[model samples]
Target chain A: MKALVHEEKTGTKGLSYREIAELEPNAGEVRVKLKTAGLNHRDIYTLQRHKPTDPPLIIGSDGAGVIDAVGDGVSDIQVGDEVLINPGLGWKEKSDAPPQGFEILGLPFHGTFAEHVVIPAENVVQKPQYLTWEEAGVLSLAALTAYRALFTRGQVQSGMKVLIPGIGSGVATFLLQFAKASGATVYVTSRSEEKCRKAVELGADKAIDSNGDWHEALGGEKMDLVIESVGAATFNKSLDQLRLGGTMVTFGASAGDVVQLNIRNFFYGQFNLLGSTMGSTEEHREMVQFIEKHQIRPIMDHMYPLSQFEQAFERMEKAAQLGKIGFHIR
Target chain B: MKALVHEEKTGTKGLSYREIAELEPNAGEVRVKLKTAGLNHRDIYTLQRHKPTDPPLIIGSDGAGVIDAVGDGVSDIQVGDEVLINPGLGWKEKSDAPPQGFEILGLPFHGTFAEHVVIPAENVVQKPQYLTWEEAGVLSLAALTAYRALFTRGQVQSGMKVLIPGIGSGVATFLLQFAKASGATVYVTSRSEEKCRKAVELGADKAIDSNGDWHEALGGEKMDLVIESVGAATFNKSLDQLRLGGTMVTFGASAGDVVQLNIRNFFYGQFNLLGSTMGSTEEHREMVQFIEKHQIRPIMDHMYPLSQFEQAFERMEKAAQLGKIGFHIR
Candidate 1:
């Protein structure tokens, strides 16, 4: 099987595209013949932090494909069933936190950046028929994150106002679409005027320049919920735009991590700050159902062949893509 | 009628114990002839921020007394009914937040420091028979804040490990008692060894030195909920003691207001930081019921006559008291 392998000696600079021994399903596991594998910021981090491994490592967190074979003790899912992988490992159900031994796929174990990957049978969910292979492949990680942050953590409701800062990444775009689909009026901010315009085109009610005064741009209208990914640079500003008793949900810190918080202002304003990341297996299932119910499609920036993994990663590293970047694997 | 008054000329330096005209009930209001009034940090704040008015402000928030009169349109409450006032005005029900026009009793309105207080009929709940005047008088503000922080905001439950920092304030002591009553294993931290000892005697499972390494003291055990009021001085350390996806609720900032937060650590650990203050009228009623059910008593440091108001305020300002301070008004 052809795979994208990261070796410690070469690190990210020398990612190799070559043939590797194919994997077989073990007990309670299934082999997926991946049709499409998605690129995420995690992949970039894995590349940058590559460590020595005996046989090199395959890395990717999202994929959609057909189950090629099922191992012993796997009865519910049959071979040839179309499915998408839930990358979160060891988290079997919805919980406040992941259980012990929880991890994401593609780290210690071989991941989805290959022609075939073997995973626990329970990690596979039926791909929504309404979505294309690219959409399904890219939907698991970012979509689940947005779903939990908006509905589960933020408790965003119909007629509520929501804010999304630094809109252009995979999660931010999903946040915009999901909040809008849930009947919330969505607002987005971006450093690029083009990204702001594109966000508005993607159903954002208002798009503010990231450098502008958000409070003034919103005419002093405060948001009921704010989805924040850019951290130190925009955290206080994002918090400032929230209404009294409003919620701000965060998944990542793309810009910087350390931020100064004013405890007096926070308590007096009666705000809620929630930290979220890749969600539970139950949330992944719910996200797929929500997409099917809304007939939502994942936005794709560009699809590269498996051999062009470097270019895809390079585009993500530069933060130039507006949506999910993917690999067209077969 | 005698009242403790704050005038612009004298401020907190010269809070006067003097005569004032007695208040009368208006339509939909009731007048309570106060037997006891409680001192809170808010009273000190009001005194410092005093402004000139035709009539000086009576500054106190918590009181319990017997209703002396009821106005037209007030039927449920009657003369001779023992009652305690809910300091939160305009918050008629429990929800995500207080409604517009919400204000605590002490600042803009005539508060409970006077011999008589006239409030909307709905602001009064029946005083529990189990409580003495002093206990009921000081229970409203601090107890309600603790109740909301632990139950409504923190969602604390039985067998949970709860942490209360700076555990000697009026609110912090209530948090200690309430969390213990809820079946949680309560831990406390205090700068004063005597205060820590008192907290353990009040039912805390363990007491850690405020300046010590709390994680080491707890054997690296993490808290499910943390009630924080000490802000900049201990905010990061307090957050560090929380488990992944744990909740930290804050109501006041006694130290400083600003603190540095590492956003990456927060999000990756999946924490919930909530800001809460005095609770709603509904929560006040519920808190009273819970107190009665648990037979919980408000911890009192000292009770001073109305003429000794200055001494009480001085004790509070110096942080010398371990529990609620009261003015024994007649």
Candidate 2:
């Protein structure tokens, strides 16, 4: 099988596209012949932290395909069933958190950036017929994250004011669409005017410049919920945009990690700060249903053949893409 | 009428025991001849921020007494009804937060330190018959804060692990008692060994030293809920003690107001950081009922006559008291 493998733990220096031994499903596992796979920021982090001593790893967290073979004891799913992978492993239900030993696909386990990948049968869900292969491939990780962040953690409601900062990422775009689909008044911010305009075109009620004066731009209105992924650079500003007793649900720290918090202001304002990450298998299933019911489609930036993995990664590294980047694997 | 008055807004120098004009209740108001009043940390904050130009402010938030007069349109309660004042103003119901124009009793409005205090009739709740006048007077502010933090914001449940750090203050003591009353296994931390022992005696399951290794002390156990008030000094340590996806409710910042937060750790851990203050009128009523149901009583450190206000403030400023400070005014 052809795979995107990394042999070193630092940088993207050891990344390569080459042939790897094909995998066979173990008991309760299925071999997915991936039709397409998606790129995520997690893939970059995995590459930067990959251990050289570990086996050469194929890395990707999202994909859609058909089961080529099923191991013994796998009864609910059969060979030739179309499916998308739920990247989060071990966590099978909605919970306050993932249980011990929980991990995402890829990394220590081989992931979706290959022609074929073997995973636990439970991690496969029927691909929503409404989504194209490219959309379904990239949809699990980002869309599930957005679903939990917006609904589970943030408790966003219709007629509520919702804010999404740094709107170009896959998860942020999903938040914008999902919040709008839930009848929320969506506000998005971006450093690029074009991206802000595009967000507005995609159903955002308002788009503010990330570098502009937010207080003045929103006419001093505050959000009921703010989906925060940009950490240090925008954490305080995002918090400032929340109304008293509002909630801020965070899942990523793309800019930086540590931020200074004012305890006095927080308690006096009566705010809620919730942290979230990848969704559970249950949430993944619900996200697919939600997208289908809303007729929502993933925003695709570009798709490339498996051999062009470097270009896709480079585009993500530069933060130049506005939506999901994909690899058309066969 | 005698009251504790602050003539200026810097330090405690301007705070003095003085005579003030007697107040008369207006329509929908009642005047209470206070038997006792409670001193809270909010009094100190009020002293430090009070404006000299503003009318000399009586600085106490909690009190219990018998109503001596009722204004026009006030019919539900007659003179001689024993009552405790709910310090939270304008917030009549429980919701995500208090409505606009909400404020505590002591700053802009004249408050409970005086021999006679006039307020809207709605702020008065019947004093629990089981409590002493001293207990009822001091219970409102701190107990309401603790009730909201532990039960409302933290969502603490029976058999859950609860941690209350700096367990010597009025609010912390209430938290220890309330969490225990809720059937939670409560852990307390204090710099003073004596205070820790006192907390344990007051029904805490464990007492950890503030300067000791918490992880080692708790035998690697994590808390489901943490009531945080010491602020910058204990913020990170309290957060570290929480289990993944646990809640920490903060209301005060006696040590410092600002702290550094690692967004990555916060989000990945899926923690909930909530900011809460005094309870709503509804929560105040509920808290009173909860106290009565559990047969809880306020822990008093010292009781002084209104003329001895200086000594009481001095003790509070030095942090020498372990529980609610009071002024007996008969």
Candidate 3:
């Protein structure tokens, strides 16, 4: 079996599609032949020297596949079962991870960007036969993040106002639909007028440009929850746009790194600044159930073959797409 | 009547004792003959021109007194009932406030440093008759703050590892006793050996010097709740000492303003940066109950005649006293 091996950690440019010796399942690990993989901006950070790891990085955090083999004492999963990989599943191993919290996949170790990814048995969750590999592969990170933001951290309620800074993100699109389905009025942002219009067609109550004029975008309305991933640029505005005592969950700071801390702003309004990370495994499992129960499908932007990983990454880098960028492994 | 009044819109130095027309209680007001006023560091900040209020400044926030009169529709207390003057009382007549957040006492309104003060009927709560007036004056801001920090915000449990950054604050002194009462192991920080010994006698399990070391103060241990108020000085270290999923509640920022955000510190450790204002009416009510039930008293450090308001402020500004500096009125 061969994989997308990286001699260096530089993201797209580091990959060398060459045949390597097949890896066998280690103790408590499962060897899965990946059918589909999802790409995220965090992968880019790892590649650009932000995340330091040993060479030959098999860097992918999100993937879905069939179990080719299971390590000794594996009790839950069987060979040939379809599954979605929990990227960061260490703490679930009942090992070093503290009780109730675990590590995320695709972060420090070899990821799922290849044909076969060896992961801990705890990291694999069974996927339904009815769902396509493409859907299963992209579901874990984006969907769980949105679920946590809307329900877990934010406490978004029916008839409440929620603002998503952009609708084109894999997570943002998930959040908009999730909020709307949960009886919330959704506000989306798009840099392009066309994309803004498209978001409205997709059930957004209002769509505004990603540009700084949010006051006019929503007619000077204050929202109950603001999902802020575009960190520095939209942060101050998010603070201003939220109703008093509202929550702003900052899970990602994509636009820029620095975030401002204004004591008077936070204290006077009684704001809750919750820094949400990826999410819990229990939350991820619940998210899958919710998506399935609601018949919700993540918005698909484009799909590519394994060899065209560079093309997919380039598109993401250019920010030209609408939803998730997926790769269908052949 | 004579009182200290600061124009809330301006930070000025001319806050002085002056005679003013006695105010009749409004429909939902209570008039009190203030016996003592607690001096807090926030008063200095208001004096430094923080609130943008005009000033012929009369500054004092925390107070204790006897009720003199009640307006129409007021039924709670009678003349001469001992009570605390909650300057930043939330819940009535003020909608711009966080439903029940801290009221900006003394800055925008005439304060307790005067002979008499008037406010909403709800702001006056019964003070423990046994407590000294100076002690009662300082009780709410620090004691209620400690209550909220531990039980309300931090939800501190029995047998938990707690790290407190400073033992000098009135809140810190209350926390030492409160944590011990809760059966928790409390470690406190101090630059003065005398203060440390006093904290130990009061109830601190261990007191460590902030002699340019983190692990030493921690006893090479991690904390479950970090009491942060020193702002940039201790903010970074507070986060480091917490266990995974631990919390740091910042109710005060005495060292300075401005806290830097280190993303990796947040993601890797699973820390929570909780911003707590003073508290709510419910919190205040609960704290009063706790105090009455436990017989906890504010450590009154110094007291002067009401005419020596400037002397009290000077002591607080110079950080020359521990616990509380208060004014005694006739």
How does each model score on lDDT?
A: 0.90, 0.92, 0.75
Ranking by TM-score: 2, 1, 3
Tell me the tens digit of each residue's lDDT in model 1 across B204-307: 89999999888899999999999999888889999999999999998888888999999989988899999998899889888988999999999999999989
Q: Ten residues in a row with the worst lDDT in model 1 chain A? A: A46-55
Off by over 4 Å in 2: none
Candidate 2 vs candidate 3, lDDT winner:
2
> What would the per-residue lDDT of candidate 1 be over residues A71-94, giving only the tens digit for each residue?
999999998999999999998787
Mind giving the per-residue lDDT tens digits that candidate 2 earns over A12-82? 78888899999999999999999999999999999877887778999999999999999999999988899
Residue A303 local lDDT, model 2: 94
Candidates ranked by lDDT: 2, 1, 3
Candidate 1, position A4, lDDT: 92
- Using lDDT as the measure, the top candidate is 2
lDDT, residue A210, model 2: 92
Give every prediction's interface RMSD: 0.7, 0.5, 3.7
